[model samples]
Target: MPHSGPSASGDVTGAGKLDRDVLKVAAVVVLGSIMAILDTTVVNVALQELTVRFQTSFATIQWVSTGYMLALAAVIPVTGWASDRFGTKRLYLVALSVFLLGSVLAGLSWNIETLIGFRVLQGLGGGMLMPAGMTLLTRAAGPQRVGQVMALLGVPMLLGPIGGPILGGWLVDTVSWRWIFFINVPIGLVALVATTVFLPQDEPERADRFDFPGMLMLSPGLALLLYGVANVPGAGGVSRPEVWLPAGLGAVLVAGFVLRATRIPNPLIDLGLFRDRTFSVAVLAMAFFSVSFFGVMLLFPSYFLLVRGESALSAGLLMAPQGIGAMLTMPVAGKLADRIGPGRVILPGIVAIAAGLALFAGVGAGTAYWQLLAALFVVGLGVGAAMMPIMVAALRTLRHREVARASTATNIIQQMSGAIGSAVMSIILAGVLAAKFGVPTSQGQLAAGAALADPATHDAAAAAAADSFGTAFTWGLVFMVVSAVPAALLLRKAPLRDELVPDVVDVPVGKTVV
Candidate 1:
């Protein structure tokens, strides 16, 4: 893939549209991205089905989602280093193949243990897709169009969480739970082929020494820390040895990793990126948003399934309003962010989210379904408007060389915060159901499933479950509001995107960039 230097291939804005080569790259990356991100929430509605299928406790079955997420958080830190050493195109292709293999293995799993194991294997590959894709797209589009491309790349991010459960629910209900994993095969194969044929090859550059120590510390530390968090529901309290020991050790190790990052010339996560005010504030907003957004999104389906006693398919269907709302706003927000600063766009979005969450914070069994759906629509609008704009703020200001590392750092931050958010929400929901009300979720889930189908005991159980979720949602709302502080700091005007691009030329179709 030779690109001629005379054409200065980097600046594609003059054409007012993406070049054929850049379009091919975008297509390949978006395909891979859909599979990876969809898997994140695809299993949420299936958690109860899995519990019954494997004859396991709810606490254990929950690990199917948690393990995959924890693995994602753990592996993301290393993706940036690998991209610089082995080229993102090669790594992206490998990541897609590995994810496909894990999907096949997971579909074949006979027990919950094997299923969780394979899911983690899937996460190993899924975790790398976003960051590598970001590096690829950012370089290909150059600064002039990075905002538009980033927004395009964000399609999966916006839709995956919404569409995943819808697809997973249909599969779990109409076909079999196993098909959830098997469905990736066709999509993955198409993605693999497209990437191989259309995406330009990139050669490895002279990268800094491998951050071996940072790798060893950060990955294991995050894994252990998330392990503790995910177990808190089962362990009952943080005081338990099962909860504190690993969490404490993991915290200490993470602190050490932070210390080492400052001393090293090239740390695995590149802490120095924090020096940029836009990037730092964007990260902080992302952290708060991820925790609240992912946590509540996790609970939303649960509320439908566990509280309303809806079937998996029904649960997915009930949440469609949120997606519909988002679909209307994402593209507009992206284009707007490129003209005005993301900050102004973000604040109103946060307010809309708060308004929607406020509705759910007081949810009860007697709440009107239409009202709930309306609230979800509002939430969707806010999410569409807010999520990508926040990312725009973070990446729009960076230098070309900084793109890969910054992408890596942001992905790690989002994944880890999301994992924690889900875990913490589970703890709160579980605690409320058991202590505040007298229904332990493990037992209550079975009874709720029955009550919904029978309609006789539905009233009492629904009331209890609704009350529990309302309490938990109130907490989630608080975190969502906190994100406003950081978002308020975003620039109201767009930055000079065209100026940061490096010089390059258009090469023949077979030419490559190194």
Candidate 2:
């Protein structure tokens, strides 16, 4: 369908109004996203179960999550070009099918090695889905509706984390660990069908040749960097050569990609996207916010299961407040940004999150449930307000043609930041535990958490573990505060009419033109 706006040669010149097609696009994308986002959190709660099932150490088992993330980062950079080459709708269906197959294989895995390999396949599918879907929605909506559309799109991102753990825990406890992966199949199928029926079909655009050199440099660099960071907990600390060597190599590769991209006419991702002031600030803010938010997400389930001796189901239920808070605020935040500007909303949102993290820093083993719930809710509100608005601001500032590159850059940055957050926080938690218990952090955390499950030593281990987690959460607070600086740099411009919907004929706010 053409944009519901004036064409360049047509007589529609005033501000463009939003149409129902934008909402339709948002709904289609959110369904696919729910499958992907839910899978991530479900696995987080299942990490401990995987360790015992596989007879492996925490260090080895963490690879399941790390590998998935690394694969996601590796594949995300090429999505911009791939979407253009294959056509977004065709690529989306293929990606969904790939993910569905990976999920089935994951459920049948005979060993940890097989499981991780299958997850990598899932990641490959997921990497394309997010950016491509975002590009499709942004194009369909135009700049005028980015904020409201982002709110609708943000639903899966917020709700998945909230619901995944609860569902994952129930399945793990009542059924089997395999069910976590198996659950994606039904959801994926539904999304695939809905998309085929509802989505607009576009002809493939003329895309440039693949940037193989750029891909080789960027993908491996990201994978290696995340790999090195993920090893920090297992290797004891950042001072270890195991942590430094791959990280150093990754830095060199990424720098090379940047230099190479500068000279090339069409790179894997357009580094030029960063030249837009709104886009740059939005990316930077999201990077900082992602590190803190994703890091804490990893920390929380373990805290509940290990430090508080809660069941996985209980821990998941406890995590619900955060998502609920986000759900409540996202629509409001989106509308506010459309009127006032993202920075105004984002600044306060960042502060609220920092305050919530501060509350976590002060938590003790015996802290009441209500206190943690309140803080989590505050954190969710901040997250809902900050995250998608920055994305909206960034996309709104770009021409419609640039939305693909913008979405790619956004996905890559968010994934890398999340990978970094999870690894760094894991290292911090492990370090604190190792120091407190006089053992390697990875081994200590696993042993202590496992020990707490036993009735005899539950109380003592809980107290000690809680202190270690509290300290690690303090570091998360620091990251959140640092994120605010970039958020503050964001421009104060409200969303404007974009060039993509030149076909849209301006209409009255409450009036519809068919």
Candidate 3:
């Protein structure tokens, strides 16, 4: 890295307040980061509407979400290398620009096929944002301040769930679903300007050999794996030609990549980073948590819209409590992780989230909205406590040079697990509905949607639909419980100083770049 070292002050005043320059960098990152964060949540709210508008089956409509995530998974392996070659600031700007272009194209899309294709374009850009932003924030704040800064940025990343739904719901309700994509234009322009004015400049970090083998192996492997997972329901099982052929081949290729990564010096994701116990455990915990957490996020809006017979806006509004819960806990968790090891903070968060999921698993059509909101609020608190701190723990222990790679690895883990969760949960919900109603999942969903539209059949359909969602939520609950095992394995210790190596000067921001 251009900057990597330890400072004496880092150890002595490890928990010191953030200075102005650091705040400015944080501000720049937050501004750019919000767009990507908001996009996912807002789209989650819109999925129900997208299904109807395109006149597609639920399985096909899912590609709009899954394809974007797979695109993120595919591009992420290159980011650590790209950031070093191109610099985070430059890469961030370019990513934002690409995302804006994708947004415009997506808004103009005529059908589900076109929308899914354009969302892949959106993923190509969104994939780079969090990892690049993480590299920037981690470098700027150094080790001692990592927790607080991560906590700070987590606000939008977390709060966007709340604001995104309200905003998306309103736009989708009153305006057009196209506006959800169009909305990014002005926000992105402002982010581009803020990045130019506020983010500091740095020369290309000393470049390393591009891990072309790792790229070839990992990218295709992830894409195939996720593709297989997404089609599992329609294919009957992994035993079918469509599922087994790709899923089996994908598993083998991914295994090969992991094996080779251990042998190569500068592998695409740097498997050796796992030598640090804190980094390894936190990542493990996060992977499991994300599989559960993101799965729940996907299923939540669908339950409200499908089972409850609510509008997009109503569904979005109903989910706001989870964001409200997250807003309350994230900062405190960040601070606690900095003081004590992440293990303590993360454990409690896992427990809280599990509790919330348990409530959701037992939900019935007649369950009170207030009880559900309370559960969402509890889930929010757990998310605030767990998600960012897990990354903070992984990064805090790594050297500054390794920070970029580490960020890239964690983001890949997150996106892949999230995609898996979405696929798995959707498959589960469809299977449950099919079993309960004795129809194919797509036919089941389409018929249910039609039945839900009519007042005559709505009440009769509600109970069965809610029960299917509850079964899927129960499956998600199991993953949440599994995630806690890793958090429990995390070690506790006082914060250590991560010194900035001498030559890593904070180049002034006045030196701007296109």
TM-score of candidate 1 against the unseen true structure: 0.85
Between candidates 1 and 3, the lDDT winner: 3
| TM-score of each model, in listed order | 0.85, 0.84, 0.85
Off by over 4 Å in 3: 1-28, 87-89, 131-155, 193-206, 275-278, 395-404, 491-514
Clashes of each: 15, 8, 7
Candidate 3 or 2, higher TM-score: 3
If both were scored by TM-score, which would come out higher, candidate 1 or candidate 2? 1
Report the candidate with higher lDDT, 2 versus 3: 3
lDDT by residue for model 3 over 133-208, one digit each (tens)? 8777766776566667767767787679899988888899899999999999998888889889878776777566
> Global lDDT of each model?
0.77, 0.76, 0.78
Ranking under lDDT, best-scoring first?
3, 1, 2
For model 3, what is the C-alpha lDDT against the true structure?
0.78
